[model samples]
Target: MLAATASQTIGPYWHLIEDDTWADLTRFGAEGETVVLTGTVYDGAGSLVTDAAIEIWQTSPAASDIFPAFGRCRTDSNGAFRFTTLKPGPVAGLGNAQQAPHIAISIFARGLLNALITRLYFQDEPLNETDPVLSMIEDEARRRTLIATRTASGAWNLDIRLQGDNETVFMEI
Candidate 1:
Protein backbone atom coordinates (compact mmCIF):
# COMPACT_ATOMS: atom_id res chain seq x y z
CA MET A 1 0.00 0.00 0.00
CA LEU A 2 1.24 3.47 -0.87
CA ALA A 3 0.28 6.89 0.39
CA ALA A 4 0.72 10.36 -1.04
CA THR A 5 3.97 12.10 -0.24
CA ALA A 6 4.09 15.01 2.17
CA SER A 7 3.37 18.32 0.48
CA GLN A 8 6.23 20.75 0.04
CA THR A 9 6.46 24.52 -0.28
CA ILE A 10 6.29 25.76 -3.86
CA GLY A 11 9.66 27.41 -4.44
CA PRO A 12 12.83 29.39 -3.81
CA TYR A 13 14.07 28.65 -7.30
CA TRP A 14 15.94 31.63 -8.74
CA HIS A 15 16.06 30.23 -12.24
CA LEU A 16 12.30 30.00 -12.78
CA ILE A 17 11.28 33.65 -13.01
CA GLU A 18 14.72 35.26 -13.06
CA ASP A 19 14.77 35.82 -16.77
CA ASP A 20 14.02 39.52 -17.30
CA THR A 21 12.26 38.60 -20.51
CA TRP A 22 9.65 36.68 -18.57
CA ALA A 23 8.57 39.93 -16.97
CA ASP A 24 7.56 41.40 -20.28
CA LEU A 25 4.31 39.92 -21.55
CA THR A 26 4.45 42.34 -24.47
CA ARG A 27 7.59 40.72 -25.85
CA PHE A 28 5.36 38.79 -28.20
CA GLY A 29 4.36 42.13 -29.76
CA ALA A 30 0.94 42.21 -28.20
CA GLU A 31 -1.03 45.18 -29.48
CA GLY A 32 -3.32 47.61 -27.64
CA GLU A 33 -2.58 49.90 -24.76
CA THR A 34 0.64 48.59 -23.33
CA VAL A 35 1.49 49.67 -19.81
CA VAL A 36 3.96 48.77 -17.15
CA LEU A 37 2.60 47.30 -13.95
CA THR A 38 4.82 47.90 -10.95
CA GLY A 39 4.69 47.20 -7.22
CA THR A 40 6.59 46.40 -4.08
CA VAL A 41 6.01 43.56 -1.63
CA TYR A 42 6.05 44.00 2.10
CA ASP A 43 6.03 41.51 4.95
CA GLY A 44 3.73 41.40 7.96
CA ALA A 45 6.13 43.64 9.83
CA GLY A 46 6.08 46.09 6.92
CA SER A 47 9.60 45.15 5.91
CA LEU A 48 10.42 44.60 2.29
CA VAL A 49 10.17 40.99 1.12
CA THR A 50 12.90 41.10 -1.49
CA ASP A 51 12.46 37.51 -2.61
CA ALA A 52 8.90 37.20 -3.77
CA ALA A 53 7.59 35.91 -7.08
CA ILE A 54 4.67 37.52 -8.85
CA GLU A 55 2.50 36.32 -11.71
CA ILE A 56 -0.23 38.22 -13.51
CA TRP A 57 -2.96 37.09 -15.92
CA GLN A 58 -5.42 39.16 -17.88
CA THR A 59 -8.39 38.25 -20.07
CA SER A 60 -8.69 41.31 -22.28
CA PRO A 61 -6.54 40.62 -25.29
CA ALA A 62 -7.09 36.91 -24.82
CA ALA A 63 -4.25 34.41 -24.72
CA SER A 64 -2.36 33.72 -27.91
CA ASP A 65 1.07 33.34 -29.46
CA ILE A 66 1.26 37.09 -29.94
CA PHE A 67 -0.51 37.93 -26.73
CA PRO A 68 0.07 35.38 -24.01
CA ALA A 69 -1.70 37.65 -21.50
CA PHE A 70 0.50 36.35 -18.74
CA GLY A 71 3.76 37.36 -17.08
CA ARG A 72 6.05 36.35 -14.24
CA CYS A 73 8.35 38.56 -12.24
CA ARG A 74 10.78 38.11 -9.40
CA THR A 75 11.18 40.93 -6.92
CA ASP A 76 14.45 42.80 -6.76
CA SER A 77 16.46 43.70 -3.68
CA ASN A 78 14.06 46.57 -3.02
CA GLY A 79 11.06 44.27 -3.20
CA ALA A 80 9.92 45.82 -6.44
CA PHE A 81 8.74 44.12 -9.65
CA ARG A 82 7.53 45.35 -12.98
CA PHE A 83 5.64 43.77 -15.87
CA THR A 84 4.85 45.06 -19.33
CA THR A 85 1.44 43.96 -20.53
CA LEU A 86 -1.56 45.14 -22.45
CA LYS A 87 -4.14 46.99 -20.37
CA PRO A 88 -6.99 44.61 -19.83
CA GLY A 89 -10.61 45.50 -20.53
CA PRO A 90 -13.73 44.63 -18.59
CA VAL A 91 -14.64 40.96 -18.50
CA ALA A 92 -17.87 39.06 -17.97
CA GLY A 93 -18.75 38.12 -14.42
CA LEU A 94 -20.83 35.17 -13.18
CA GLY A 95 -24.05 35.09 -15.18
CA ASN A 96 -25.47 38.31 -16.58
CA ALA A 97 -23.06 40.59 -14.82
CA GLN A 98 -20.00 42.57 -15.85
CA GLN A 99 -16.75 42.80 -14.01
CA ALA A 100 -14.44 45.77 -13.94
CA PRO A 101 -11.20 45.63 -15.84
CA HIS A 102 -8.82 43.71 -13.65
CA ILE A 103 -5.69 41.65 -13.67
CA ALA A 104 -5.50 38.49 -11.60
CA ILE A 105 -2.28 38.19 -9.64
CA SER A 106 -0.57 35.60 -7.47
CA ILE A 107 2.38 35.83 -5.16
CA PHE A 108 4.74 33.10 -4.03
CA ALA A 109 7.08 33.87 -1.19
CA ARG A 110 9.07 32.05 1.51
CA GLY A 111 6.46 32.15 4.29
CA LEU A 112 3.40 31.36 2.23
CA LEU A 113 2.36 27.69 2.20
CA ASN A 114 0.48 28.49 -0.99
CA ALA A 115 0.46 31.38 -3.38
CA LEU A 116 -1.74 34.30 -2.42
CA ILE A 117 -4.31 35.16 -5.07
CA THR A 118 -5.75 38.65 -5.63
CA ARG A 119 -7.20 40.82 -8.33
CA LEU A 120 -5.88 44.27 -9.28
CA TYR A 121 -8.61 46.68 -10.10
CA PHE A 122 -7.87 50.00 -11.77
CA GLN A 123 -8.30 53.08 -9.65
CA ASP A 124 -10.85 55.58 -10.93
CA GLU A 125 -12.27 53.11 -13.40
CA PRO A 126 -15.98 53.79 -13.80
CA LEU A 127 -16.93 50.14 -14.01
CA ASN A 128 -15.58 49.58 -10.52
CA GLU A 129 -18.61 51.35 -9.13
CA THR A 130 -20.98 48.66 -10.32
CA ASP A 131 -18.85 45.51 -10.63
CA PRO A 132 -20.40 42.67 -8.72
CA VAL A 133 -17.12 41.67 -7.16
CA LEU A 134 -16.25 45.19 -6.08
CA SER A 135 -19.76 45.81 -4.83
CA MET A 136 -19.43 42.87 -2.47
CA ILE A 137 -16.91 44.78 -0.40
CA GLU A 138 -18.68 47.48 1.57
CA ASP A 139 -15.58 48.65 3.36
CA GLU A 140 -14.08 51.28 1.08
CA ALA A 141 -10.67 51.24 2.69
CA ARG A 142 -10.16 47.49 2.48
CA ARG A 143 -11.51 47.48 -1.03
CA ARG A 144 -9.11 50.19 -2.03
CA THR A 145 -6.26 47.85 -1.28
CA LEU A 146 -6.94 45.98 -4.51
CA ILE A 147 -6.83 49.05 -6.68
CA ALA A 148 -3.88 49.93 -8.89
CA THR A 149 -3.34 53.63 -9.14
CA ARG A 150 -1.68 55.20 -12.13
CA THR A 151 1.69 56.66 -11.43
CA ALA A 152 3.14 59.85 -12.82
CA SER A 153 4.84 57.85 -15.54
CA GLY A 154 1.50 56.33 -16.49
CA ALA A 155 2.32 52.96 -15.01
CA TRP A 156 -0.01 51.06 -12.76
CA ASN A 157 1.21 50.72 -9.19
CA LEU A 158 -0.24 48.43 -6.55
CA ASP A 159 1.73 47.50 -3.50
CA ILE A 160 1.12 44.20 -1.69
CA ARG A 161 1.38 43.80 2.05
CA LEU A 162 1.48 40.21 3.27
CA GLN A 163 -0.03 41.19 6.64
CA GLY A 164 -0.04 43.82 9.35
CA ASP A 165 -1.57 47.23 8.80
CA ASN A 166 -2.52 47.40 5.16
CA GLU A 167 -2.67 43.78 4.19
CA THR A 168 -3.65 42.98 0.66
CA VAL A 169 -6.97 41.26 0.14
CA PHE A 170 -6.01 37.79 -0.93
CA MET A 171 -8.86 35.65 -2.15
CA GLU A 172 -9.40 31.99 -1.40
CA ILE A 173 -8.81 29.58 -4.22
Candidate 2:
Protein backbone atom coordinates (compact mmCIF):
# COMPACT_ATOMS: atom_id res chain seq x y z
CA MET A 1 0.00 0.00 0.00
CA LEU A 2 1.17 3.50 -0.77
CA ALA A 3 1.73 5.89 2.10
CA ALA A 4 -0.39 9.04 2.23
CA THR A 5 1.26 12.44 1.83
CA ALA A 6 1.41 14.80 4.76
CA SER A 7 -1.30 17.44 4.96
CA GLN A 8 -0.27 20.95 4.07
CA THR A 9 -1.62 24.39 4.90
CA ILE A 10 -3.35 26.59 2.38
CA GLY A 11 -0.87 28.07 -0.08
CA PRO A 12 -0.45 31.73 -1.08
CA TYR A 13 -2.40 31.15 -4.26
CA TRP A 14 -5.76 31.01 -2.49
CA HIS A 15 -6.91 34.16 -4.21
CA LEU A 16 -6.72 32.37 -7.49
CA ILE A 17 -9.82 30.38 -6.54
CA GLU A 18 -11.67 33.00 -4.47
CA ASP A 19 -13.76 35.69 -6.08
CA ASP A 20 -13.03 39.22 -4.89
CA THR A 21 -16.78 39.97 -4.78
CA TRP A 22 -17.11 37.61 -1.80
CA ALA A 23 -15.49 40.29 0.33
CA ASP A 24 -18.52 42.57 0.23
CA LEU A 25 -21.57 41.29 2.07
CA THR A 26 -23.68 44.21 0.86
CA ARG A 27 -23.11 43.51 -2.80
CA PHE A 28 -26.78 42.55 -3.05
CA GLY A 29 -27.99 45.74 -1.33
CA ALA A 30 -28.57 44.50 2.21
CA GLU A 31 -30.64 46.89 4.27
CA GLY A 32 -29.50 48.31 7.62
CA GLU A 33 -26.86 50.66 9.04
CA THR A 34 -24.09 50.00 6.56
CA VAL A 35 -20.49 50.39 7.57
CA VAL A 36 -17.16 49.56 6.01
CA LEU A 37 -14.90 47.41 8.16
CA THR A 38 -11.25 47.62 7.22
CA GLY A 39 -8.06 46.26 8.74
CA THR A 40 -4.64 44.79 8.17
CA VAL A 41 -3.19 41.42 9.15
CA TYR A 42 0.27 41.19 10.67
CA ASP A 43 2.57 38.31 11.49
CA GLY A 44 4.64 37.65 14.61
CA ALA A 45 7.37 40.02 13.45
CA GLY A 46 4.79 42.76 12.81
CA SER A 47 5.17 42.38 9.07
CA LEU A 48 2.19 42.45 6.71
CA VAL A 49 0.63 39.08 5.87
CA THR A 50 -0.51 39.62 2.31
CA ASP A 51 -1.96 36.19 1.73
CA ALA A 52 -4.31 35.82 4.66
CA ALA A 53 -7.95 34.89 4.22
CA ILE A 54 -10.56 36.36 6.56
CA GLU A 55 -14.14 35.17 6.95
CA ILE A 56 -16.80 37.00 8.96
CA TRP A 57 -20.12 35.59 10.16
CA GLN A 58 -22.82 37.85 11.49
CA THR A 59 -25.38 36.21 13.79
CA SER A 60 -28.51 38.34 14.06
CA PRO A 61 -31.57 39.13 12.07
CA ALA A 62 -32.81 36.32 9.90
CA ALA A 63 -30.95 35.89 6.65
CA SER A 64 -32.68 37.56 3.77
CA ASP A 65 -32.34 37.81 0.04
CA ILE A 66 -30.20 40.85 0.57
CA PHE A 67 -28.22 39.86 3.66
CA PRO A 68 -26.51 36.51 3.51
CA ALA A 69 -24.92 37.17 6.93
CA PHE A 70 -21.51 35.95 5.86
CA GLY A 71 -18.57 37.17 3.80
CA ARG A 72 -14.93 36.40 3.01
CA CYS A 73 -12.01 38.56 2.01
CA ARG A 74 -8.37 38.07 1.18
CA THR A 75 -5.69 40.50 2.26
CA ASP A 76 -4.17 42.69 -0.39
CA SER A 77 -0.50 43.29 -1.08
CA ASN A 78 -0.50 45.64 1.92
CA GLY A 79 -2.18 43.03 4.13
CA ALA A 80 -5.41 45.02 4.26
CA PHE A 81 -8.94 43.65 4.00
CA ARG A 82 -12.32 45.34 3.81
CA PHE A 83 -15.95 44.31 4.23
CA THR A 84 -19.11 46.25 3.47
CA THR A 85 -22.08 45.18 5.55
CA LEU A 86 -24.80 46.24 7.93
CA LYS A 87 -24.45 46.48 11.69
CA PRO A 88 -25.48 43.31 13.49
CA GLY A 89 -27.75 43.34 16.53
CA PRO A 90 -27.18 41.40 19.75
CA VAL A 91 -27.49 37.64 19.59
CA ALA A 92 -28.42 35.20 22.32
CA GLY A 93 -25.59 33.41 24.05
CA LEU A 94 -25.36 30.49 26.47
CA GLY A 95 -27.90 30.37 29.32
CA ASN A 96 -30.04 33.06 27.75
CA ALA A 97 -27.26 35.62 27.97
CA GLN A 98 -26.99 38.14 25.17
CA GLN A 99 -23.78 38.65 23.27
CA ALA A 100 -22.74 42.07 22.07
CA PRO A 101 -23.27 43.10 18.54
CA HIS A 102 -20.17 41.68 16.91
CA ILE A 103 -18.93 39.79 13.93
CA ALA A 104 -17.34 36.37 14.33
CA ILE A 105 -13.98 36.24 12.54
CA SER A 106 -12.02 33.30 11.20
CA ILE A 107 -8.50 33.87 9.94
CA PHE A 108 -6.52 31.56 7.71
CA ALA A 109 -2.87 32.32 7.06
CA ARG A 110 0.46 30.75 6.31
CA GLY A 111 2.24 28.79 9.08
CA LEU A 112 -1.01 28.22 10.99
CA LEU A 113 -2.03 24.59 11.31
CA ASN A 114 -5.59 25.70 12.04
CA ALA A 115 -7.49 28.89 11.38
CA LEU A 116 -7.52 31.43 14.19
CA ILE A 117 -10.89 32.61 15.52
CA THR A 118 -11.72 36.03 16.96
CA ARG A 119 -14.45 38.67 17.01
CA LEU A 120 -15.00 42.30 16.02
CA TYR A 121 -17.06 44.39 18.41
CA PHE A 122 -18.02 47.96 17.62
CA GLN A 123 -16.53 50.45 20.06
CA ASP A 124 -19.66 52.57 20.18
CA GLU A 125 -21.98 49.71 21.14
CA PRO A 126 -23.26 50.22 24.67
CA LEU A 127 -24.08 46.53 24.91
CA ASN A 128 -20.39 45.71 24.80
CA GLU A 129 -20.05 46.38 28.49
CA THR A 130 -22.31 43.47 29.35
CA ASP A 131 -21.33 41.16 26.55
CA PRO A 132 -20.92 37.60 27.77
CA VAL A 133 -17.73 36.97 25.83
CA LEU A 134 -16.19 40.39 26.44
CA SER A 135 -17.07 40.24 30.12
CA MET A 136 -15.29 36.93 30.53
CA ILE A 137 -11.96 38.46 29.50
CA GLU A 138 -10.24 39.53 32.73
CA ASP A 139 -7.58 41.69 31.14
CA GLU A 140 -9.00 45.06 30.11
CA ALA A 141 -6.22 45.70 27.62
CA ARG A 142 -6.65 42.36 25.95
CA ARG A 143 -10.40 42.89 25.68
CA ARG A 144 -9.79 46.10 23.80
CA THR A 145 -8.13 44.11 21.07
CA LEU A 146 -11.48 42.82 19.87
CA ILE A 147 -13.14 46.19 19.64
CA ALA A 148 -13.19 48.02 16.33
CA THR A 149 -12.74 51.75 16.35
CA ARG A 150 -14.88 54.04 14.30
CA THR A 151 -12.95 56.16 11.83
CA ALA A 152 -13.63 59.75 10.85
CA SER A 153 -15.11 58.49 7.61
CA GLY A 154 -17.74 56.48 9.56
CA ALA A 155 -15.89 53.30 8.76
CA TRP A 156 -14.75 50.78 11.38
CA ASN A 157 -11.07 49.84 11.69
CA LEU A 158 -9.47 46.94 13.58
CA ASP A 159 -6.13 45.37 12.90
CA ILE A 160 -5.40 41.71 13.63
CA ARG A 161 -1.97 40.94 15.05
CA LEU A 162 -0.92 37.31 14.92
CA GLN A 163 1.78 37.71 17.60
CA GLY A 164 4.00 40.11 19.50
CA ASP A 165 3.08 42.30 22.47
CA ASN A 166 -0.05 43.56 20.71
CA GLU A 167 -1.21 40.20 19.49
CA THR A 168 -4.96 39.79 19.08
CA VAL A 169 -6.96 37.57 21.43
CA PHE A 170 -7.93 34.51 19.44
CA MET A 171 -10.75 32.32 20.77
CA GLU A 172 -10.71 28.55 20.94
CA ILE A 173 -13.74 26.51 20.01
Candidate 3:
Protein backbone atom coordinates (compact mmCIF):
# COMPACT_ATOMS: atom_id res chain seq x y z
CA MET A 1 0.00 0.00 0.00
CA LEU A 2 1.23 3.54 -0.78
CA ALA A 3 1.78 5.85 2.19
CA ALA A 4 0.08 9.24 2.00
CA THR A 5 2.28 12.30 2.35
CA ALA A 6 2.88 13.14 5.99
CA SER A 7 1.74 16.75 5.67
CA GLN A 8 0.16 18.08 2.48
CA THR A 9 -0.90 21.67 2.08
CA ILE A 10 -3.17 22.86 -0.69
CA GLY A 11 -2.60 26.27 -2.26
CA PRO A 12 0.23 27.20 -4.66
CA TYR A 13 -0.43 23.99 -6.60
CA TRP A 14 -4.20 24.30 -6.79
CA HIS A 15 -4.28 27.41 -8.95
CA LEU A 16 -2.26 25.66 -11.60
CA ILE A 17 -5.24 23.45 -12.36
CA GLU A 18 -7.81 26.26 -12.53
CA ASP A 19 -8.98 27.28 -15.99
CA ASP A 20 -7.04 30.36 -17.05
CA THR A 21 -10.12 31.35 -19.04
CA TRP A 22 -11.83 32.18 -15.74
CA ALA A 23 -9.63 35.28 -15.61
CA ASP A 24 -12.00 36.86 -18.08
CA LEU A 25 -15.42 37.31 -16.56
CA THR A 26 -16.89 38.44 -19.85
CA ARG A 27 -16.32 34.98 -21.25
CA PHE A 28 -19.95 34.19 -20.45
CA GLY A 29 -21.09 36.99 -22.77
CA ALA A 30 -21.58 39.69 -20.15
CA GLU A 31 -22.53 43.09 -21.52
CA GLY A 32 -21.75 46.57 -20.20
CA GLU A 33 -18.71 48.78 -19.78
CA THR A 34 -15.96 46.20 -19.82
CA VAL A 35 -12.83 47.08 -17.88
CA VAL A 36 -9.55 45.42 -17.13
CA LEU A 37 -8.51 44.95 -13.50
CA THR A 38 -4.88 44.16 -12.88
CA GLY A 39 -2.65 44.04 -9.82
CA THR A 40 0.35 42.49 -8.17
CA VAL A 41 0.62 40.66 -4.88
CA TYR A 42 3.30 41.61 -2.39
CA ASP A 43 4.48 39.77 0.70
CA GLY A 44 5.45 41.29 4.04
CA ALA A 45 8.96 42.05 2.85
CA GLY A 46 7.65 43.98 -0.16
CA SER A 47 8.58 41.14 -2.47
CA LEU A 48 6.34 39.84 -5.18
CA VAL A 49 4.23 36.75 -4.48
CA THR A 50 4.48 34.54 -7.53
CA ASP A 51 2.20 31.72 -6.50
CA ALA A 52 -1.13 33.14 -5.48
CA ALA A 53 -4.75 32.72 -6.57
CA ILE A 54 -7.19 35.62 -6.70
CA GLU A 55 -10.93 35.73 -7.31
CA ILE A 56 -13.39 38.59 -7.63
CA TRP A 57 -17.17 38.77 -7.39
CA GLN A 58 -19.42 41.69 -8.17
CA THR A 59 -23.19 42.14 -8.06
CA SER A 60 -23.83 45.21 -10.22
CA PRO A 61 -24.28 43.35 -13.48
CA ALA A 62 -26.05 40.67 -11.50
CA ALA A 63 -25.34 36.96 -11.93
CA SER A 64 -27.96 36.28 -14.54
CA ASP A 65 -28.38 34.15 -17.62
CA ILE A 66 -25.22 35.47 -19.19
CA PHE A 67 -23.09 37.05 -16.51
CA PRO A 68 -21.61 34.85 -13.84
CA ALA A 69 -20.18 37.99 -12.21
CA PHE A 70 -17.23 36.03 -10.87
CA GLY A 71 -13.70 35.35 -12.10
CA ARG A 72 -10.44 33.85 -10.88
CA CYS A 73 -6.82 34.38 -11.86
CA ARG A 74 -3.41 33.32 -10.70
CA THR A 75 -0.34 35.42 -10.16
CA ASP A 76 2.45 35.11 -12.68
CA SER A 77 6.21 35.10 -12.21
CA ASN A 78 5.98 38.86 -11.79
CA GLY A 79 3.27 38.40 -9.16
CA ALA A 80 0.74 40.09 -11.41
CA PHE A 81 -2.84 39.02 -12.13
CA ARG A 82 -5.47 40.43 -14.44
CA PHE A 83 -9.17 40.20 -15.08
CA THR A 84 -11.58 41.59 -17.68
CA THR A 85 -15.11 42.31 -16.62
CA LEU A 86 -18.00 44.77 -16.63
CA LYS A 87 -17.82 47.77 -14.31
CA PRO A 88 -20.17 47.49 -11.36
CA GLY A 89 -22.53 50.14 -10.06
CA PRO A 90 -23.56 51.10 -6.56
CA VAL A 91 -25.56 48.44 -4.76
CA ALA A 92 -27.71 48.40 -1.66
CA GLY A 93 -25.83 47.92 1.58
CA LEU A 94 -27.04 46.76 4.97
CA GLY A 95 -30.03 48.90 5.97
CA ASN A 96 -30.69 51.97 3.83
CA ALA A 97 -27.03 52.79 3.17
CA GLN A 98 -25.63 52.22 -0.29
CA GLN A 99 -22.33 50.62 -1.04
CA ALA A 100 -19.87 52.02 -3.53
CA PRO A 101 -19.36 50.27 -6.79
CA HIS A 102 -16.88 47.63 -5.76
CA ILE A 103 -15.70 44.11 -6.33
CA ALA A 104 -15.33 41.66 -3.44
CA ILE A 105 -12.03 39.84 -3.60
CA SER A 106 -10.71 36.65 -2.02
CA ILE A 107 -7.05 35.67 -2.15
CA PHE A 108 -5.40 32.31 -1.56
CA ALA A 109 -1.67 32.11 -1.18
CA ARG A 110 1.07 29.70 -0.15
CA GLY A 111 1.44 30.80 3.48
CA LEU A 112 -2.19 31.29 4.35
CA LEU A 113 -4.66 28.78 5.77
CA ASN A 114 -7.90 30.68 5.17
CA ALA A 115 -8.26 33.04 2.21
CA LEU A 116 -8.04 36.76 2.93
CA ILE A 117 -10.97 38.94 1.93
CA THR A 118 -11.16 42.55 0.77
CA ARG A 119 -12.81 44.86 -1.72
CA LEU A 120 -11.71 46.93 -4.70
CA TYR A 121 -13.28 50.31 -5.05
CA PHE A 122 -12.56 52.18 -8.26
CA GLN A 123 -10.74 55.49 -8.19
CA ASP A 124 -12.85 58.56 -8.86
CA GLU A 125 -15.98 56.69 -7.85
CA PRO A 126 -18.17 59.31 -6.18
CA LEU A 127 -20.08 56.67 -4.35
CA ASN A 128 -16.92 55.82 -2.43
CA GLU A 129 -17.29 59.00 -0.44
CA THR A 130 -20.45 57.65 1.15
CA ASP A 131 -19.83 53.94 1.11
CA PRO A 132 -21.08 52.49 4.34
CA VAL A 133 -18.27 50.02 4.70
CA LEU A 134 -15.62 52.55 3.80
CA SER A 135 -17.09 55.04 6.23
CA MET A 136 -16.39 52.60 8.99
CA ILE A 137 -12.66 52.97 8.35
CA GLU A 138 -11.51 56.09 10.19
CA ASP A 139 -8.09 56.33 8.67
CA GLU A 140 -8.19 57.83 5.20
CA ALA A 141 -4.87 56.25 4.31
CA ARG A 142 -5.99 52.83 5.43
CA ARG A 143 -9.20 53.25 3.51
CA ARG A 144 -7.19 54.11 0.43
CA THR A 145 -5.87 50.57 0.40
CA LEU A 146 -9.28 49.41 -0.77
CA ILE A 147 -9.35 51.72 -3.76
CA ALA A 148 -7.99 50.75 -7.16
CA THR A 149 -6.60 53.40 -9.43
CA ARG A 150 -6.88 53.68 -13.20
CA THR A 151 -3.61 53.29 -15.00
CA ALA A 152 -2.47 55.21 -18.06
CA SER A 153 -3.40 52.21 -20.13
CA GLY A 154 -6.97 52.66 -18.84
CA ALA A 155 -6.86 49.50 -16.76
CA TRP A 156 -7.49 49.62 -13.02
CA ASN A 157 -4.78 48.36 -10.69
CA LEU A 158 -4.63 47.81 -6.95
CA ASP A 159 -1.73 45.96 -5.41
CA ILE A 160 -2.33 43.75 -2.39
CA ARG A 161 0.19 43.71 0.42
CA LEU A 162 0.17 40.71 2.73
CA GLN A 163 1.78 42.70 5.58
CA GLY A 164 4.05 45.67 5.65
CA ASP A 165 3.97 49.46 6.00
CA ASN A 166 0.89 49.72 3.87
CA GLU A 167 -0.68 46.34 3.98
CA THR A 168 -4.03 45.84 2.32
CA VAL A 169 -6.89 46.00 4.79
CA PHE A 170 -8.30 42.51 5.00
CA MET A 171 -11.91 42.23 6.12
CA GLU A 172 -12.96 40.01 9.00
CA ILE A 173 -15.53 38.22 6.89
- Among all windows of 10 consecutive residues in model 2, the one with the lowest summed lDDT is 4-13
Query: All candidates' TM-scores?
Result: 0.92, 0.92, 0.92
Please provide, for model 3 over 79-167, each residue's C-alpha lDDT reduced to its tens digit, 9 standing for 90 to 100: 99999999999999988989999999999878887788999999998999999889989999999999999995558999999998889
In model 1, what are the clashing residue pairs, if there are any? none
lDDT of 3: 0.90
The sequence of per-residue lDDT tens digits that candidate 1 reaches over residues 1-173 is 99967645556674563777888988978778888899999998888988888999989878998988888898889999999988888899889999999999989877777789999999889999998877878889889989999995558999998898878888985
TM-score of 3: 0.92
lDDT of 2 by residue, 38-143 (tens): 9999998989999988999987755688888899999999999999888888888899798889999999877876789999999978899999889989899999
Pairs in steric clash, model 3: none
TM-score (C-alpha, index-matched) for candidate 1: 0.92
Runs of candidate 3 exceeding 4 Å displacement: 1-9
